[model samples]
Target: MAAPYLPMSQEEMKKLKWDQCDFIIVSGDAYVDHPSFSGAIIGRVLENEGFRIGIISQPDWRNTKDFKKLGRPYLGWLITAGNIDSMVNHYTAAKKKRSNDAYTAGGKSGRRPDRATLVYAQRCREAYKEPPIIIGGIEASLRRFAHYDYWDDKVRRSILIDAKADLLVYGMGEKTIIALAHELQERRAREEKEQSFAIDLQGLCYVTDTVATLQPQEVITLPSYEEVKESKVAYAKAFRLQEQEQNPYNGKILLQQHQDLFLVQNRPSLPLTTKELDAIYALPFARQPHPSYANQGGVPALEEVEFSLAAQRGCFGGCSFCALTFHQGRIIQSRSDESLVEEAKELVQAPSFKGYIHDVGGPTANFRQQACKKQAKAGACRHRHCLFPEPCKNLEINHDHYLQLLRKLRQIKGVKKVFIRSGLRYDYLMADKKERRRRFLEEICQHHVSGQLKVAPEHASPKVLQYMGKPSIKVYEDFKKEYEETNRKLDKKQYLVPYLMSSHPGATLHEAIEMAEKIRDWKYMPEQVQDFIPTPGSLSTCIYYTGIEPRTMEPVTVPRTPKEKALQRALLQFRKPENYELVYQALCSAERQDLIGPGSKKLISPPMSQKFKNRKLFSDKEGRGKGKGKKRRH
Candidate 1:
């Protein structure tokens, strides 16, 4: 009934009884028709509009052979670098090549090129130069501006220039893509070669040779590409200006010069209403990886999300390291409870249904509405965060709607458990009235948690927290205490897994040592410690490249070298035997040798081998004698 997964090949298209596809989507991910996959969602949305759509997933970029699989489309070609930025997907924070890609079949890597969007766009041009090329998704969205590229270690030009795409869609592109599709359809019917495609559409960017015709009042010009490329101060200023104009209601057009060409970005598209969001999720989705991938063990990325429900979209937490503000924007758009419950019924009927729904949430699971009433009309405040340095007094801290949705989901027939796996903004939760917060925590601990609830406190240093745009460690501590107390009353043996990070901007060795000390006091061994990766289009990445916080224009210490990053990361997990040497060195460097001894208060025990003992690892007079006048490494 749904044309069985959007005709990935000509044979499939023939089976659908369609002569030609209205649009073709090319993605770096394996074809997974689930709502969680962006390509699938776009394809289905187009199909729902009575337009025939085809998709080519993870095509061979070496030649035009694979790109020709879907043939040419009647409307245009939509290209994306899958769910992740291709560079981030291929490399680690240390720039080491990754061996596995969850979006690929059999968990293998190298299926897609390093910059998949750019590669795919070029191949599309090679195959058919007539069709208009459009680039979107996480890769193109974040790199839409001339910003930092960790892989290249330099500021790259806007992706629109590199990809040579006719139009670049930023943010969640459901509304923007639909509008473009209709406009293309109208142009095709008219046979109008003179009428150009609309460049004034919201959430779209285009390149032009001149800005002489543009109105000065409607456009705000950022520092030119050459200016930002040469000056860190100019780069910071450009990022600040871009962030300020992100609001859809009051935001103005942004223009940036690249050599002789100008990149014009229209204001963001408005957030979708509940009714609109509900219809999009309810669109007929096959809700699984294309049957072709069954033999290759399917796409690993879909495993966890197969039975999960997406209750909402967008986040307002404003973590500096996250690109949600750049992609999904700050306003929250949620689906109706009836829609979620109906989807749950369908999941229960699947043959692989396990009686458990793995997750039921969005970017921030508990965030189900706009931050405040004003956000609906005025859009999110441009210069301030809702719950960062401190929760705004006007911030609406309510979890009632989310609780109702979860309750309704758990009540569905044949459903065993409904877990909230998405990250919960504990600061926002803690800001709620005590009774409501307690009730929400109690319900989650009693019914939703699957033995462990993962919350991201990120770091413990106040300086790093401020740079990260996160609440103080005190907020996390209060939430942790309340959570433990709630589990105690419920007599559940659940634990809190705090997501920790290291080597973020503003984190010197001293701050790293401070975090290690806190971990020591809490007696928590972080199983995983994320070393900050400076992916494109995040405030933290901008600061990493410029050494200046865009918001304050103040310099911050950045852990850029491999040695410093390693030492800082080791400090978070000092208990690991493999990290003993690095932790000892960090302790000595931070003048925190007090933490490397054989006591319960110490973070790690002194090295047992003579090799480390013979080195002058400490600067203090007491440990100087142990080295026997050997030169100190520090």
Candidate 2:
């Protein structure tokens, strides 16, 4: 979740007594509301399969007493590799430097501190030393290998080497967790009868067999961190091989050296069915924030609703910088409007309800349903890649359903105002000139928009946008115009807050200057100028290093240095004289001699000499300069 959506205090936590957990699954993520709650869902799945379970709402894993309060599990503790490492991610920034696995920034990558795997492992070891601790999640799934730790700014081995967890379970945990629990309980009983009977903890790796045997678990040949740092592609391949084999925990075949980085070899991630999803929606949501925090500016403002709901899941848009397509796939699944309305109704009755429904959207909100029926009719297409190079051809462009849903939510009693705060694919919404669609948007704004709308254009340069697998700037302009015109007609003064990214791999200093010039023309200073973070499992990561798509094999020029990335980002907000000087100096240092003067067709730079180059951010040595002899006329 973004910083804007941080959780509230204790009092607010009380109003939303939404859950009466049978076995509190203490986790890093806020309970239930996380987009893809695979950890929580798997726990529930096991419970439904006749295993008892409860979730200990976010506990201070740093404290031993906290773990004790969780009490003894009816079965055992199921720890997980958090959905994403809690470390600050800059994968998007790395992608801006190269087109593939060729260049990774040294300082910006690593495992996040909030990752449940590390935090929970430490807590379990200290507090509940007896019941088994099982780890699984994104943190443990993808990087379960010897890889680099961006936070510490050094290369490190597998997570197991760091977390010291008893058992590291990988991939999905639905069937695996249930089996482990049953084995533990059964083993305890068998010991009483025979005094020597043991249980084999299947689908996991544990340090000790207190409930089973006294023998040591065998080891296997695993990739070293040095080997992985040398070649990420090879590491990905090595893990993929392990993932294909069955019986992940059978002796030495199991790779356990860096269990944290080791990709789970066996258990498959189970996709949820419609019924299963409905059950999740039906689960109680304790939407309360702590009260003391609320009064002392500790809770999220009243304008902020205690919880957010995901109306849909998965995105078909294969933006190179996004991980949704790889992790969740391009398929879009959704909850029915009836379910959403029910959830909204429940939200209103809460004691903390402010009457305003903050947001009801997910993964490009207006895409309340999947892509067109044509694609569904043909089944999953084998085109291998999206055609848009940005928004795939199969991306279903329909806002009619979404429009209806929003209108219904607004009509709910006690709901003061329903807003759509999630990112809206502006291009998708404006593709057709259908008067009905346009008018529907007009009405939605009149009813739902909270004075501002966020749409991501990413970059203005055609080449950069294309390289980013995004729609052209003209498409973004079209959407902006339509949005403005719609609001104008309704007398609603809301404005489109377009999201932009600087330092994408394809953007050159000149292109960046052009983007900066575009910002000046728009007369809008953005609140957040996003630096790209190229996360793992995204098409952009390959492009960040290789400068070409593996499938098409096209030639690309990646921006591969710190100075280039910094200059490009600064251009997005070049207002101060200092900013201009910094950008001008940066351009000169990069040997971009032609952009120094006031008469250039592009954005200009004031001249600075070689004496300033050593100064931080800007200096004379990197200053704008006249060409070696004469300025080349464009």
Candidate 3:
């Protein structure tokens, strides 16, 4: 039997023989920190196949010695998307905006250390002259073509070609990794010679080898970036149809402009059973945050602050900016409460324990115990996702299980506090304010809050909300007021933190102005404003570019420029004079001039205060020796 990975140290490396190891998985993120990430689950899946595995987490590929130390491997190298940052920026950027916490270090700007896959491939090239390098996970999978990256805040192309990996494994590699390992082992056993056995390296390539050397096989063709980035209308016509439901290729929008498009045909994204998830969660975890790997001026990975336990997998909310629907699937599956409680027990006892559990939820977390038993009789409900554009009538609102689980978690011995920091779909909690108070009062007060509950009212305008598939602003406001009143009456101090989205489809200047009015009424600066990122596989991305929902056949007014989006985001933040001028101009340009002085006039642009201008000097030095230039249309 292979020795466990506990207390992984250089001393053990000195004792262990390299020949015994079958594969080494190198990641840009920490190993086994959170079960939801590809780094954690993929490693376990490969290990289950009886392959000797070792992990090099948060690897400093820039450091030659660190890369060399992880060199032992009998078969190949498995590179992953990482638990924190995506793969493409393995050499360069960190994703988490200093506030949210899920971040890790990497190369300086314009100096990414080398995508871990590329770096590992180059390292393997130096060591074995020619060894297989397989790259997969979100970073490799999503970046298979030119797509916008939120981390780098730009567009980039296929990671396979860029990273220089031998085989780019797209989609979930639970079975694929095992298959590759088996094939390699079989080749080794048959040839009785490493040199002769190298001929059967199918689905594998090297920088030095040409594609012509391999025998003809049915290789899935990758769609071009241009094909994916086509006009939204063209993309919708090609893949958006109810009749083509099973066509995995349809939901995938490929741009014709990009090279190195990955073929995801026949890829298996197998869902895990509850027991399997429990076992995976039970794996020995190193809970403390590595302060040594900290970046001087970036967000630290949240995994460092508190132990993260994924109580569930997958999301039912089909937000346009999210890719979870395509990747994790829409079905919500959860680990048992017993499993979660056990993890929490260990977390509180961890040397790095901070007395609180950071978060215990999964994609649209409040849906932990929610599932449609109606699916059995209705036969696998055809709905894309339950909470999309709006809640489905069939969505079973069962917070009882989650309530019980939260209660059980509070019972843990060493745990001082447990908070549900993930997005709470407030629409699902439909009890009357009275019933809500009675049932959720104690639940909210004792558990599931970090003094604030986060809810996503993506947009406030009815037209925009309709396109976003979200609830009305009134619905959110009602809940927010009720939550505050309940907390106040109970003598508990708590607030609701709402996440807003800007530049969504159907959001015109008029609608944005109306949203600004709502913000002024609330009188709180929104700390986070998510700019709509049109990721692949989201129904919203289709609407984003096409201005029409493929399924609903509804028209939307989409933001056409980055400048407009920036102006709109500034309006939402609503603090600076430049932002005030932008908002004022946007309203005037859209012919809603009356909204410039906003006082509950359904204005999307807030009124500019004299104080907003007082902060800045209008002298020549402030504006290149001239007063501020006349504002242009947003």
Candidate 4:
């Protein structure tokens, strides 16, 4: 029989007729027992392995009272800053406090403290010092190495050191966590001290006192923490080295010095096989926020994913701004079609499932398979990208499996519509054979699209796009024309919504203005714009801090000041009245004052003055019609 939601309290544990939990997961988000949320997946996975699991979600960090709610676990404490990094969750790219946190029950802010993994780990230790604390999730995964912290504006040491965690798991940690669990269980069975367990597990990072025990040829030593903290050049070098060794097949152990101790990261865990992935997703999940949140409004993050299916995991698109390469890795790991169909049928049985499947893709919707055959045997190429400046000749671009899966999903009884809300790599699509590409686009426009399809073109400037690891703007233009033509053929009035970003590391005012002009030509006013945020563990963030692209070590322009960033962002939405001044300043700064005028080709209209305005415009037209007895047309 499937399990109920993992016990969140001692009373729930007692109700289940248990004296203690084998492990307690402490997270910074509300406990939503859904596969989409990490806490639930970890808890359910452990439960499947016959371990008693309890969760303490968004515990108050001010004291150990909440952390001690579950009492001491037999295994240890698993820590995470929820689905997202706590700092990123709390603040915007501009360092402004966010008004609502979707992870929290009531969409309220300030539920989790800053650097939540660190704080949560500290509290867990304070609550019970004997058991080991293992940290994972986006926060720990990205910050496992010494990294540039955007919030601090300086290099921070590896999170494992700061959090004082015994071990840190990186990437999608299903396989790694299971390994750790079994090891801990064996140690407990043998009555061994947790600290005495020598953990050299893959996809894990730990601090050791010496490298003398490690084989010299099996390890790659990175720059010391002091070196990276003191020099941008060293930081870039360190980032470059770490990125190169990410391949699980050929990757070696990574070691870095943090003052007196050595922070060691084992090679990444192997990607899960299709059968393994299917089994993991098939694990029992209640697929709802814990009922305790009934009054406070359930976790807002679960809404989008409640009825959706995560078709696959990982991306090989290699966008410089994306963190998937670090977290989920570049290799694609997908579940079997049978598993997905079964899950979709389950959704149909739900009372609130309104005949719609919200989404059916992972990081990149169209990426249903590995980039090439070589990836399966040898792992992803360390030095080159599958899709970047140009699609690699070895790249295998196909959408037949995805199309078949979608067809099956939409045909499911009571599932009226199946949508593809996740990002679609148009460049990869365009690289496909003409007939297949046409068929896929036609089917998408005819069946999948809900009206507007959202895609990320990111920027219009070639230089900026290159820095972003995105294809040329011409690629997007080609794809856009093809998309529109496909919709026209199907007699559907569907449109494309292009996602644009502003103030990326390599973008100057010139590039920003160029993008603004492209937006003008497209007659599209984006409601929301993405400002390039320097999140940890991304190539773009490395350039944002070092002022040099790590790959080439060439200096790149970086927009660091708030004023400059504001100007760049304003240019992306120059049509807005609120952006007038900033847009004007940007135009002047670029020496393109011609773009600021009353002409149709101009980006913004010149500022209006009372002296130049027509007097009749300000006249009381309403009063003139009312008082003079002139009737207004209805």
Candidate 2, residue 101: lDDT: 17
lDDT string for model 4 (173-253, tens) is 988899899989988989986476446777889999988989999999999999999999999999999999998888989
Model 1: how far is 436 from its true place, Å? 0.6
RMSD of 3: 6.6
**What is the per-residue lDDT of model 3 for residues 534-580, given as tens digits with 9 covering 90 to 100?**
65446666676566777766676778565567557766866554555
What digit string (tens of lDDT, one per residue) describes model 2 on residues 162-223?
A: 67654555444444566665665677666543322122344444333222223234434446
- Compare candidates 2 and 3 on TM-score and give the better one: 3
- Ten contiguous residues with the weakest lDDT in model 3: 246-255
Best-to-worst order by TM-score is 1, 4, 3, 2
Counting only residues 3 or more apart in sequence or on different chains, how many pairs clash (N, Cα, C under 3 Å) in candidate 3?
27
Best by TM-score: 1
Better of 2 and 4 by TM-score: 4
Error of 3 at 393 (Å): 3.3
Using Cα atoms with residue i matched to residue i, what is each candidate's TM-score against the true structure?
0.96, 0.71, 0.76, 0.95
Predicted candidate 1 versus true structure: per-residue lDDT over 103-220, tens digit per residue? 9999999999999999999999999988899999999999988988998999899999999999999998999999999999999999976537888889999999988888899899
Report the candidate with higher lDDT, 2 versus 3: 3
Q: List all candidate RMSDs to the true structure.
A: 3.9, 9.1, 6.6, 6.1
Least accurate 10 contiguous residues by lDDT in model 2: 99-108
